[model samples]
Target: RAIAGIMVTIPEYFAGKNVLITGATGFMGKVLLEKLLRSCPDVKAVYVLVRQKSGHAPSARIADMVNCKLFDRLREEHPNFPDKIVPMSSDLTQPELDVSREDQQTLVDCINIVFHCAATIRFNEPLKDAMQLNVLATQKIMALAHRMKHLEVFIHVSTAYANCDRSVIEEVVYPPPVDYKKLIDALEWMDDKLVNLITPKLIGDRPNTYTYTKALAEYLVQQECGSLNVAIIRPSIVGASWKEPFPGWIDNFNGPSGIFIAAGKGILRTMRASNDAVADLVPVDVVINATLAAAWYSGSQRYTRPKSLLVYNCTTGGINPFHWGEVGMNVSLV
Candidate 1:
């Protein structure tokens, strides 16, 4: 069903519910946070897991996040929007997510929903680092979610290219290239140089460590969803905002956003891509909407669909398909 159909009363579903979000500083995470705050004004609280980056503390970072232009509408409407957002100092790369005991207990007691969006998106990231952040971190989060007494839904954000080894991608958890457990055990004692040397062979036909680890992470998440109301959202080549807060409200130079910017500035003169290849560019707002709706649907249908993981292929190609040739033409015009 469409997100609009599933979530007829979006605010009613979210009202008085506490949401815990990871990667609240990232592009999609920020938009998710904004939508929850702006649309679900009655939401009890939003707890964000953040680590100190650069010289800024987690609280300082979240303060800066709300102050960004993305939250302008929320700020104008509800000047106290920031009050509902509580930042918990936590590191995804660490064991148990480095969430303090007090914060962990608080989350266990109060958090009603979780959005696990924190992941290293760098395509060229080292295998060990990617596994640590993407795979192990997810495992830790799942463990935490299992302990959450009041948890209603657990939404994990994965990429559409996770199973890109296959052309026809489906909304299901496919078998990973390698057994994640064995791979993690092997990498434990292996030298970094040796791992780097064999990285290409290890990844096989997959493009990068990012997708490879994400696939492993999905497998792990599926395995751990013993009794949890789990849902996975796989968004393809997320681009600038198409609606909601504003159009073209993009900050980072990752994915298509970077390409569009480089093309506009004449930095990306030409690109090599098959004309017939699908350009599955999904808007950030649409992805967030689907994510929120998935959370709501999971909770509402808990009895009807007990413990079954719902995988949403939040892509545009299957519905409104576009080709890379059109993208090139548009970039050229830019």
Candidate 2:
């Protein structure tokens, strides 16, 4: 690996190139942003799409995000890193992602890379909300990418479980259960009650609306990318960081992290799962690294785009070192 510390080509590809990222404040998004600045310090600018939340304006949220614990090392090193993070007001659930005319124009003119990370992750999110955020939002972003003058590559973050309806998962986009357009049009007339009533039926053998829509989003990406280079990253059961951006860096208490924390604190907890069953838990940073590398590969040949779609399924299976019982024992000892 370059003789133990040589600058690599991934960073070189990003050097002086403007990058646009949605979901910059989310868990994986934060790590991706920090890594881009820390590893590719010469990147021209990172335009993050942010919408007002909890009474905080887009700019305020961006400021707070850059100053979070995640970016401590980055701040210590590159004091001017904040200058490179430009916040663009946006709401993915709205038309055109709620991005302003001027901002849209700016991105169209200058953006080199686009990372679509914003989505409704809540498993219980309503069907209508899920469709708006997951499927239609993808289409809106694709529309924006089509108009970009300097766009090199578009990276879409999807879930590994998106194709859970299948017996065996492969590194490819499976055909969606239903036509995205017909369903979207149907939802327009149906109220939440109607949508919820038929949510399970509509999802059809898929576990939740989240996975169901993600599958549709993948198919939509393939259809809408047109001539733009595109790549998709499917990460399963993303957990805390293994290394990079500091160890044990995680804010959410989901999956294994939640179980261990509650168990350690003597919170009344009993769960059902076979210890021997493989947990496809992958580190967030590892996913980010794979995503960045895929971006480079997608746009390597700017003129002649070789791969129209690069799909990466980031998950752990087969033989694995650790298991739930072993991990639980260690946490209890602590």
Candidate 3:
């Protein structure tokens, strides 16, 4: 049933659609890029917003990106698949995201959908840096999306733990402890170390600045209201795929999953998390598929309730209910 639905929906609906995916170099982003290309072969173009890193040009980055093993299937199908990939150079931290006027105009004229996945994923990122990348970057993206004349949908890939302070998290935007604008202002003026030192006090109950700022980002999206067709996909800790392409094929050993790997290798000693605590992990492919579906659904079903933003909590907690101990055991075995 799932395979039939994907076949019926993807190419027929997504073909020739101009998509702009940020953070195309990241793990989840790579998976998304591969899936789209392999599944929707005729996709008009994929405009990936990438920053020039280590003196490498945008074109060079694109060249390196397509050559990755993730795009092996696409490479085999269409060796010239690189042509359909338009790499746009833009820095997230800059005002207007540093996108050139000409490039911005090009995006406005052509882009139909946007996947905003770029962000500082580090749990220990400085508060100021976190605000700049996670919060301010999102604001800048929203501004750019507003100018996209042909934009149909804007999907924000937010974390499900953004509302972790609450016991039973809901599909809704929870207010942050600090005012978004005030926090931005404070971080702008204060020293990085000072901000980092006070972060714990500032973000009460919240584990780190990452989740706190992400929650603020959701609020900013809500501020968009009637202006844009938006969907907030709050996915739990993304794990190895259950289907599509392959299973248990993970790359970077980051997040809690990294801890599991370390524990399995006998590298990690003591653990902090409770053994029986629910490990809310949703597969990367599932999240990508759900995001694609949500983007389509959100576009067709416009929200009439302006006060409430569309939040879909994608997690196994409500369904599978796997625990941390189970995850540890699985990692050890696999």
Candidate 4:
């Protein structure tokens, strides 16, 4: 069944719901927006939480967001997508995220779903910087969500690499390397230079700050489990899908996208990774679909469940295994 112009199995479920999504300008957020608009044309509104950057207002940021190539297909289908997609100014790093009282009240009054995809995803970010974005921002979002009168579900996006130190990953949240609260307290008193000097010792064997903070954020979500309906999605090395939208279409060379694009041009010769290890690249559209499905799942069972939180390991290792070398050659040839 199709509802509000979206092709979905459960059309009536989200036909006219007001949803709020953070990280609207990110890679996956763009795909999620396209999917929802194309499938659910009847959705009442989508309030995107974006920061006021470079002195631009929230509306201006949204205007630029919709004009991006990611929304080109949506524009073709509904040339006036701006009418449904609304951007709300917010700074996740701020104490209260800089969300005005009016905006907060607006969200509480209307929002039914919240997708928290905003976070600093840099692999080399400093400890303090990473915590500011990944951990503190999450806590602030939860605080706001707790005040929502009509909030149904909050979906937090986390990386599968949060537990990369383990040889095999599980579907449950793992204990972080350090006591998160203690770490935060220490960082609060320490100078930036002092924090940087001890980052290596603090993080231990973790490859980078991104993974370290994400692990802590997972625990933070657990602490708020009693109050908020949340789900944590851990996606491993998200890559271009084999199908959907288009194959071989990718933007940015930060993650495996870099390797794929490099291999395509035959410029990137070698890289670091266990050749035989399973490649867990998931498609953007697939993850977005799973996210929406999870939201619906959480919403439908709200009464019976106890402010539930589900953790999904979005990996293709057990079902289908592709090696890095195989992907390299495949991208090079086919």
TM-score against truth, every candidate: 0.95, 0.94, 0.91, 0.92
lDDT of 3 by residue, 254-319 (tens): 876688778888898667777789888888889888887776666544433332457888888888
Q: Candidate 2, residues 147-228: lDDT per residue as tens digits?
A: 9999989999999999987878878888897888999999999988989999988888888889999999999998878888
Tens-place lDDT per residue, model 4, 1-334, is 3345554454456778898888888888877777787677778889999888899988897787778666777788878778998788888888789988899899989888889888888988988999999998898888888888888788999998898888888778888878888888998999999999999987788899999899999999988656678888888877765554555445677777887777788798778887797777888877888888878777766666544468888877778888866877688675
lDDT of 2 at 144: 94
Please list the residue runs of candidate 3 whose C-alpha ends up more than 4 Å from where it truly belongs after superposition.
1-8, 300-308
Q: Scored by CA lDDT, what does every candidate get?
A: 0.90, 0.87, 0.81, 0.82
Superposed by TM-score, candidate 3 places the C-alpha of residue 146 at a distance from the truth, in angstroms, of 0.8
Between candidates 1 and 3, the one scoring higher on TM-score is 1
lDDT of model number 3: 0.81
Q: By TM-score, who's the top model here?
A: 1
Clashes of 2: 0
For candidate 4, report its TM-score: 0.92
The top-ranked prediction according to lDDT is 1
